[model samples]
Target: MSSIAEQDLADRRARAIQQLLHTPLLHRDTPSFDTIATSEQWLKEWFLRTCGWILIVDYRRGMARLRKVTGWIDSTHPQRSLRTGKSTFTIRKYVTFCLTAAALGEHGRSRISLQDIAVAVSDLSVRAKVSPFTDLDHKDRQALVDVLMLLSALRVVTELDRTGRDYSVDPTGNVLYEIDERRLGQLLVAPLPPARCSTWQQMAADPHPQPSSGAPLDAHRLRQHLMRRLLDQPLCYLSDLPDDDAAAVSDHTEHITQWLSEAGLALEIRADAWMVVNRRAGTARSLRDGSNVSNCALLVLPQLTAQPSGWISATHLATLVDELLDEYPWWARSLRNDRNRADAVATVLRSFDLIRPQSDGWRIMPAAWRWAARVDPACLPPSSSPIPTQPAQDDLFSVEPTHQ
Candidate 1:
């Protein structure tokens, strides 16, 4: 291929990889469908080779799914609501989701009304000895509606009702839906059917299960597991991995780094952790987004890095936030309260694995040093001297890819 054609192909492949990472299930109507569909073959091979993920593309039906598997379950990322501030799914919502899916699978006809689905789900819930869906309860009704909306988003079901009103608004409203049986069948990416597994651990079992104690390690599977964590998680810590896997990472650092680079990601390796940074805008959340929580987290970083022992007591952290609040009067009004602001900052930092809770307090992780702010002489507090210099890097909190 010509240089121009080769560049275009590379760009398309990168974009497709990113799209699947952000949204694993891509429907025909999604804006990136054409790009992903065109690069289907490359994506399949690339994902399988790099992360052991399966990429399924259906051209005629217009859908693509990246069946992702990981050695560990990530509770941080959950199936969230598409509406109402995009809240994470609650226990009720999860139960309702499973019940609804079961009901849909059992329904003989492709067309069903919202009311009928509720009745079917309730029946199933009762038979399964779980909490039955109460149609009269607003919370119960809303949870069911949320599940249906999620299914619609996945293209497993299409709402036929054109009414502008939401089903959540009226529990008795009959919303018609046309189910796509094929898409629904493809929704579950489990290695085996739920009926065959009694526990969730069994359901999510790896096809080529990890070897028992003292057994020889499978180098290829180890690489796949490591790559999967790098691609799917915010950060991969050496301490979190088994000794064998950690050693593998050190032994094959160069190979793994090259693998990430080919996918348009920069591998940022610290002494204790690895972070895959995507230069593409909007690929992931950045600390510089100027949101209240993110801004606070950035401000809190200096305090975290300043600690000599790499640990900060919760009380001390709150005091730091209070001082910052007084210094930066222009901060969001919502953060006026010291405790709330401190909690928000800590939560955001923890989400990025920059700081982790310890029995004593919060331990500033090695990755936290990457975002250490440069102390300005003009803004230095009267009692506090400049923080000790940190190891140099190209940028501060920049998601832009950089060579190590």
Candidate 2:
């Protein structure tokens, strides 16, 4: 290929990678960043090579699916609450999703109405010795509708007449939908059926269940997996690697660094974890958001930095949140659920490796110092100062949290 052609192909691949990383899952009916990426063999191969994610392209169904096998705490996306306007997904919503998926599989229909779905879900849930859908309170009913909307967003179901969000307000409200059974079947990317599994722990055990020595490590595939992790996570720890992968990484360190540098990223090697550092990368959230959760996380950062032991109890964290709410009543007065606020803050912190949940409590990770001086400088007291210039008593980066 000519230089110009090569550049064009590189640009297209870059855009496609960005799309998959951000959205992860794609459906036939939804608007995708690049429709061509799904159909093109090269793009499909790229995803497989890089992430170990299986991109199933069912052209007949107009569906392109990425079956995720690894990475992150929440493999299945937890959507925002439509009725309550929260980022966190509640238990009610989770139960509703289970009911919905079960109902759809049992229906065996081309098209179905919302009321019909509700009835089907209720029957299925009751049969499974789970909560009956009919017994749902107004909030639970709304949650059911919310999960339906999420399904619609993924194009598993198409809204024909009234919107899914509309049904959240009025359960009795009539809405029409056309179910895409093929796409719905692809929604759950599991190796085994739920009936065979004893616990949720079995889900992530080994996505590819085969004899350990069946196949040798495909060098190209391994490289792609590393690249995918570099792009997907803030930090990839060496300790997290399987034996074969660790050997591959050790053998090809220089080559891997070259690949990352070519892709506009620099590798930061530490004792435990490796970071794909990009100084110019943009983040979704700013520190200035008036939301109580964001403010709480900001307030907690300084105290977290000042901790001598590098760990704080959940009780202490909640107390710190309470102090913040007391000081900034105007900021958090509208926030009703104190527990949810702390959970949300922790979620945000964990994403950036600022704090990790431990057996005792949440441990302050070394990467958290990046925000020590950056967040609410005027608001924090002098005693809870930023990380000291000199080397700390403990080597922060020397240790990695074994807890998930």
Candidate 3:
């Protein structure tokens, strides 16, 4: 192929991979479905080879799914609401989601009424001895509606009457839905059937288990595990990984970098860590956004980097936040009196692996140096220096090596 043609193919494949990473479940209505469908073969081979993830593209069903599994349980990414603001699913909503799925799976019709599904869900909950759903309780009714909305988003069900919201408000109100049984069946992607698995560990077990002794023949497994960590996490610390996996990373750094580059991700290698930086947008989370939490995190970056020992006490961070609130009067007004603002900022920072929770407080990670504000010596006062001003742009994953 010509250079131009090869570049175009690479870009198309990269876009498809990014879309799958952001939203693992893709349906006919998804904007990037055409690119994903066209490059299905490449995507399948790439995901399987790189991360051992399964990529299923059903052209007949007009949907695609990437079954991704990580070495550890990741609580950072959660099934969020489809509405504006995108609130994370709560425990109640999660329970309702499973019950609703079971109800739909057991129903014997292609078309079912919203009220019927609710009744079925309540029945299943009672039989399972879980919290029974009651229309009398507004919270229960809302949770059911949320689950339906989520299903609708996944294209498992189509709300024919568009009155699903009404059921949440009024117990008597109902809506009709057309169920897609095939899509419903594809929802669960576990290594073992959930029925046979008694514990979460069993459910998440890898079917192709790697040898514990790290034999040369099983080197591919180590590579897959390492790639999965680099792609799925914000940062892959050598200390956080198993000894075998960490050794594999150090031994085959160039090979891993080439694999990531094919998917339009840059592999950032550090003495103690590695991180995959997306070349394109929409593939990863943004920490420089205009949200209150992001802004707070940015404001506190300087304080974290200024610590001589890289460790700061929780009480000290809270006091810093109070002083910041007073210094920047125009900052997030809602957090002005919120005592938990410090904790919220810490959570945001921790999500990016910029800081880690220590026994005493939080310790700033090496990766945080990329976003830390630098003080200007020329403008420093004789007695004390003001809070350092942040750079004009906080480019994600663009940083200099902290160590030689």
Model 3: ten consecutive residues of lowest lDDT? 375-384
Candidate 1: tens digits of C-alpha lDDT, residues 1-404:
99999987776677667778878888888666797788778788989998878899998999888988775666655677887644679988999988888899999898988889989998999998997788888888889878988999888899787554666777657789999988887778776668899987788887776577745357777777778888887589888887777776766677678777667677876667778887765345555666666766676687678788889998898888777767656555676844467877877788778888998579988778777643232332343433334444434344443363
Model 3 misplacement above 4 A: 83-86, 162-165, 193-201, 208-217, 313-315, 331-343, 359-361, 373-404
> What are the clashing pairs of model 3?
none
For candidate 2, the clash count comes to 1
Clashing pairs in 1: none
lDDT of 2 by residue, 292-357 (tens): 666567667877778788898888877766766655545555553455666677776776666878
Rank the models by TM-score, top first: 1, 3, 2
lDDT of 3 by residue, 1-404 (tens): 99999998887787778778878888878777888888888888999888888999998889999987874777766777775244678888899998999999999899998889989988999997898888888888878888888899899999888553477788888889999998898898777768899986898897776566755425677778788877777578888866666676667776788887777778777666787777575555567655776776777777777788889998998887777666666657877766688887887888889888898799988778666654333322233335545553334334443211
lDDT of 2: 0.64
Show pairs that collide, candidate 2: 50-224
lDDT of 1 at 276: 80
TM-score for all models, in order of appearance: 0.84, 0.72, 0.84
Cα-lDDT of candidate 1: 0.76
lDDT of 3 at 303: 75
Off by over 4 Å in 1: 162-169, 193-201, 313-326, 333-344, 373-404
